[model samples]
Target: MNSSPSVKIVSKCFVKPKTILEESKKPYYLSPWDFAMLSVHYIQKGLLFQKPLHSTDTLLDKLRESLAIALVHFYPLAGRLSAQINENTKSYSVFVDCSNSPGAGFIYATSEAVNHDGRTMSLLTVQVTELVDGIFIGLSINHAMGDGTSFWNFFSAWSEIFQAQESNKTDELYLKNPPVLKRYIPQGYGPLFSLPYSHPDEFIRTYESPILKERIFCFSSETIRLLKAKINQVCGTTSISSFQSLTAVIWRCITRARRLPIERETSCRLAADNRGRMYPPLPRDYFGNCLSALRTAAKAGVLLENDLGWAALKVHQAVADHTSEKVTIMIDQWLKSPFIYHIDRLFEPMSVMMGSSPRFDKYGCEFGMGKALTLRSGYAHKFDGKVSAYPGREGGGSIDLEVCLVPQFMEALESDEEFMSLVYF
Candidate 1:
């Protein structure tokens, strides 16, 4: 395992929106989907790029300027979170205060580290760390503000604005697919609800994360296609997708590595997006939290004894089962009895949870430093069983799996024959 790199903060300042809205004080109400994420950790992600020829002065100025302009369209990101409690109802409401706000935090730091720990309370925080041979731009976006789709949309838009600076098209540039500002609240559920919490932070608990070693494993496109085909043949079903096959492989490998009890309950939690699943489906570009965790479980003995096809079929079933009815039912239930998912909820025994997705345009964020050398995640919402998936930097439908687990489990996985055979590096 590599040693954890230390970081030193050079500068930190809040970057307000470059342009104010016509209705400055309008509050963006929290949707049922958005409110459900109040207690979760931030989505921490970063990009690695080789050193740009531009000087630090020029680079910093460009980043600050572009981010401010990006916030002009993503104005809600520039505001602060406002929470108010109703004593009689014993509930609270939280929303983005778009009044005179301090905006996102722009951080300048120097470090050998590329991943930033998502410890800030700010809605939108970015760290631009200057490395010895590259620049690491890490972002800590609040999950309440958006999901994976919205997060990448902000990145793509920001990058586009930055890339257009040389062509002098900044003034006329507009968001090709601007975010839909309307919040999603389930039918008959409400425009406002008294949450079951006294404060947002109270529900968003704080606890020390366990020591875990993380490694990146890459699988090629050809290998994935072959594996998917094999699984489908064995299962006698052509519906299993490449994603299901890959996820099944990893889940099985990790279960073996953990060396759990034979009768132990084992499960995989998949963050399934609701945009396409909703009836009259949401705009592909609709912003805000529209995702739910699809959890599927089995006995350890059953899982280990089953073939890869069986496991893949289970995954496929989970996706197929996540219909629009399920999404609405989920929201309806949350409104009835609201609850927060703490970090420990993700690190259960013999469990694996998937975060992010291979579908995101991870390598599309190019800010003149050429294409990203690779995509990396930060230290938030990460645990022994958490897995993040990204498209390979080389493209070609390849996939990269970022696996985090206990040190011993990691060592066992590295030695697993079937697991390592498909790993490209």
Candidate 2:
């Protein structure tokens, strides 16, 4: 590893939105979809780029100014959550206070060579660090505010505006797909529906988070193509998708690496997008947490015993079964049950969850930087079995799987020849 210089923070400031929210939208209501994520932690992600020719001051100013303008469309980022307990139900209700208060956090830090909370803070925080040879932008957004799609869409649009200003073409800059802020509230549900948790703290799921380690395994176009092809060929069917095939390979390898008991159940969960699965269907860019966590499981021994194609086929079935009808049913059920997604409710021992997606425009946010070098993540939803996917920086059919696991399991996975041989990097 190269020895890098440390970064020192030169400045910190709050960049409010260029515009304000209308009074009608003041207590911006939170939909069932958004409320479900109240127990989740903030989403932490970073984008890295090679240092640009512009001075740090210029770069920081443009980013901040562009961010302020972008917040006009994503004004929720400028607000904080206002929660209240429902007297009768003994549950808490939360909504975004879209008032002009603490906006997004902006930090400017530059390394000599070089080189970073949650609740009651700004809903969004952005930190741009100038490295010895690059820049790293760190983001922490409340989970209830949005999901990965919303997260990247706002970032992409912000960068789009920045690039326009950098080239002095701000007049022509426009967001092709502006964020759709309308929450997806189920029918008959009032804006004041309270969650099952009496207090906001009741929604939080706590556990002894073990020391964890992570590795980003790269899968090239050819490798993924061959893997998909080979798996289907083995299964004697062509229904397996690139995603299913790749996820299967990972699930199987991780199970083997963990050395879990044969009888134990190992689960594979995928965050399925609900935009296409909604009743009337939502926009491709509809903001907020419009996603469902789909899971499938098998005994560790059974998963290891099966061929890669067998594992892929199992995952494909789960994906195929989540139709619009089922999605509607699940939402309706939530209305009756009204449970929040606490950690215990979603994660478990020996389970792997596929999050983010290869479809995200990971490199589309130029911001006048030549090219993004790589993406990094902060410690947020970093459970041992969490796996976040992103399109490869090179952007072919390539993909990057950011795998987080307990330290010991990560060590075993790195040395597992079967897994390493299949990955491009």
- Which sections of candidate 2 miss by over 4 Å? 1-8, 21-25, 108-119, 206-208
lDDT of 1 by residue, 307-417 (tens): 998899899999999998998788778888876566676457668998889999889999889999988877667678889999988787889999999899999999999
Question: Could you tell me which 10 consecutive residues in candidate 1 have the lowest summed lDDT?
Answer: 110-119
What are the RMSDs of all candidates, in order? 3.2, 4.1
TM-score, cand. 2 vs. native? 0.93
How many backbone clashes are present in model 1?
Answer: 0
The CA-based lDDT of model 2 is what?
Answer: 0.80
* lDDT tens per residue, model 2, 292-340: 9888999999999988888998899999999999989888887898877
Best by TM-score: 1
Give the C-alpha miss distance for residue 401 in model 1, angstroms: 0.6
TM-score of each: 0.94, 0.93
- How far is 144's C-alpha from truth in model 1 (Å)? 1.2
